[model samples]
Target: MNKVPMTVAGEAALRAELEQLKKVDRPRISKAIAEAREHGDLKENAEYHAARDQQSFAEGRVMDIESKLAEAQVIDVTKIPPTGRVIFGTTVDLINVETEEAVRYRIVGEDEAEVKSNRISVTSPIARALIGKEEGDTVIVRAPGGDVEFEIDQVQHI
Candidate 1:
């Protein structure tokens, strides 16, 4: 499999989630299953089945996180030399050329992309158009709403 691009913060978040699932959720579910088994007649026991389902989901997530961590290429953008270009993990400020609306976005890996926080995936339309671009560069993004024009105002490697 190809190496998965992940930021240092993203890797830390995944590790934290894996720890919680293994250390807390795993034991809690095990205890619940045991208590449910004591009640007998598991064939009709809703609690037992519920606990089992939760266990399956949790275990699957743990495996997924482990696999991602194993294949992750954690990038520390701060350690990179500043070149004033829009690269992975760079926070970019842009303005809509037509509407003059200002917006900010950080280019991140697929796993860490959160639109609500303005973190866009590297493969996203705007990010793709902005990649390798520098301040004052114009970008045309083919968005779902239609083609939109933007101007790069600044790039910060935070």
Candidate 2:
């Protein structure tokens, strides 16, 4: 399988969730299942069925996280030498050429991309255009709305 690029922080977040699900949620569901089983026949036990469903979901999540971590290639942007070029895990400041509006975005893994948080997926159109570009460089993104031009004001490794 191809390695998936992920920021150190993104990997850490996934690890944290995995640990919580394994140690906390898994055990909690197990207890619930056991308690539900104690309530008598399993055929009519709604609680047991619900608990089993929860267990299945949690187990699936654990497997997904495990697989993702196994294939993840963590990149610590702070440790990389500052090349002034945009890359995964780098926070970039951009100015919309047409509107002159300033915006900041951090290029992150697909799992961590949250537009509200100004984190964009590395595969996003803007991020793809920004990658390998240096500060003061202008980039044009083919956004779904339309083609938008941006000026790279700064790039920070954080």
Across 1-158, the per-residue lDDT of candidate 1 in tens digits comes to 89978899999999999999999999999999999999999999999999999999999999999999999999999999989899999999999999999999999999999999999999899999999999999999999999999999999999
Instruction: Please give me the total number of clashing residue pairs in predicted model 2.
Output: 0
Backbone Cα, N, C clashes tallied per candidate: 0, 0
Against the hidden true structure, what lDDT does model 2 obtain?
A: 0.96
Clashes of 1: 0
At residue 62, give the lDDT of candidate 1.
100
- Model 1 vs. true fold: TM: 0.98
List of clashing residue pairs for candidate 2: none
**Candidate 2's residue-wise lDDT over 47-92, tens digit each?**
9999999999999999999999999999999999999999889999
Ten residues in sequence with the least summed lDDT for candidate 2: 80-89
Cα RMSD (angstroms) for every candidate in the order listed: 0.7, 0.7
Q: Give residue 32's lDDT in candidate 2 (0 to 100).
A: 100
Candidate 1 local Cα displacement, residue 68, angstroms: 1.2
TM-score of each: 0.98, 0.98
